[model samples]
Target: MKIGLIGSGDVGQALAHGFTSEGHDVKIGTRSPRENLVSYSDASSFGEIVVIATPWSGTKAAIDAAVAGNFKDKTVIDVTNPLVMRENGPPELALGHTDSGGEQVQRWLPGAHVIKAFNIVGNAFMYKPEFPHGPPTMFIAGNEGDAKVAVTRILTSFGWETIDIGGIEGARLLEPMCILWVLTGVRSGNWNQAFRMLRK
Candidate 1:
């Protein structure tokens, strides 16, 4: 599988590494990319699946630059949280309740099958996370059932137990969970924690 990463930040790089470990070819898209990196358009056109990991603020621009049509019919994994940085404390969600980053990304790439994922945990735990208990749960949301299934397979490869919460609107709930994750880390000074769903 050819995977295109829309951002070259920590999250993108971590996911790229994970995908490569799973035997998928990966390309990272960014402005002013270095030797191995490629432009957003080039990466998007080359990938079978496109992963959007850009920061919330720059996400729209990245999509525009990537040529939205290049993502037509492609499964797009959205790993962004609508966060606004705060000088006083942890970042705050820029939008919620009615709107979310995942929905926004879907709107940006109307031709793409967009799935919301990987925004609830830190980048360090994104791939092959190890926990004393067991593999943590990753909640994903997307309108298309098949697209969610595809992302679930990728999550399983990356060592996560996945739960499809519902349509992209579920991002309204998942995005806020990211702030909770960050707040917990800020309070405890531990970035190793991840969310798990208990079942019997």
Candidate 2:
């Protein structure tokens, strides 16, 4: 599998490394190309699966730059949080309750299977995370059944327990969960935590 990552930030790089370590060919897309990074269009065209890891502000532009057709019929993993940071305090969701980044990305690439994932945790744990209790749960939201399955497989490979929350609209819930993660980190001053779902 060739994984194209649309954003060379921490999240993208982390997932790219994980994919490569999992024996998949990985390409990172960026505005500034370098030895390891390729242009967004090139990366998108090169991948069997595309990951959208761009910051929320530039996600649309990155997708546009990658060419919408390049994502056609491909599984697109969205790891973005639509945040508006401030100097005074913790960041807040740019939009929520009715709209979300995942739905917007789906709208942007109607031909692509956009799945919202990896946004609820920090980049440090995006790949293989070790915990004393057990593998943490990763909640994914997407409309396509096959795409969600694919993402769940990847998450399992990266040492995660997954729960399919159903449809891209579930991002409305997942995105806010990101805020909770952040606020918990801010208040507790611990960045080394992840979420787990308990079953009785």
Candidate 3:
């Protein structure tokens, strides 16, 4: 699969490497595409799947600038959270409890199949994950069943145990998980911990 990544930051780089290592054609898109990196055009042309890994603030613009026309039949994985980061302290969710970044992305790209994944896991664990025990759960939610399945397979290839948390509305809850992830990182001074869904 040809994967188009919209950001070149930590999350983008991590997922790019993970996918490329799995033998998938990966293109990392940036506002300023360098020699090694590809432009948004390169991404759009090579896309089988497009992953929006940009910061919460630039999510809409990135999508608008990256893809042309309606991404109606394409699966666009939204890995962003509406976290408003302050210079003095940690990040907070900007959209509040009612709406989420994933939903907002879906709203902007109305025709695209938006799936929320990788928002709960830290960047450190995004690749071929090796926990103390077994594979950690990756929570995913989307309105499209087929899109979710494709995302699940990709995530599982990267060694994640996927959990389908219903439809896009589930993002209302999933986006807050970023706050929990960051809070745990700040409180314990460890950003390596990831949430795992266990059925008891």
**For candidate 3, lDDT tens digit of each residue in 85-190?**
8898788789856777888888887888899999887888899778887888889999899999999999999999999989888898988888888888999997
Ranking by lDDT: 1, 2, 3
Candidate 1 residue-wise lDDT at 127? 99
Model 2 error, position 24 (Å): 0.6
Q: Write the residue-wise lDDT of candidate 2 on 1-200 in tens digits.
A: 99999999999989998999999999999999999999999999999999999888888899999999999999999999998888998888999999999999999999999999999999999889988999999999999999999999999999999999999999999999998998999999999999999989
Model 2 C-alpha lDDT versus the unseen true structure: 0.94
User: Model 3: which ten-residue window has the lowest total lDDT?
Assistant: 63-72
User: Of the candidates numbered 1 and 3, which has the greater lDDT value?
Assistant: 1
Please write out the lDDT profile of model 1 over residues 69-172, one tens digit for every residue: 99999999999999999999999999999999999999999999999999999999999998989999999999998899899999999999999999999999
Question: What CA RMSD would you report for each candidate?
Answer: 0.7, 0.6, 1.3
lDDT of each: 0.94, 0.94, 0.85
Off by over 4 Å in 1: none
Between which residue pairs do clashes occur in model 1? none
Q: How do the predictions measure up, each by TM-score?
A: 0.98, 0.99, 0.95
Runs off by more than 4 Å, candidate 3: 68-70
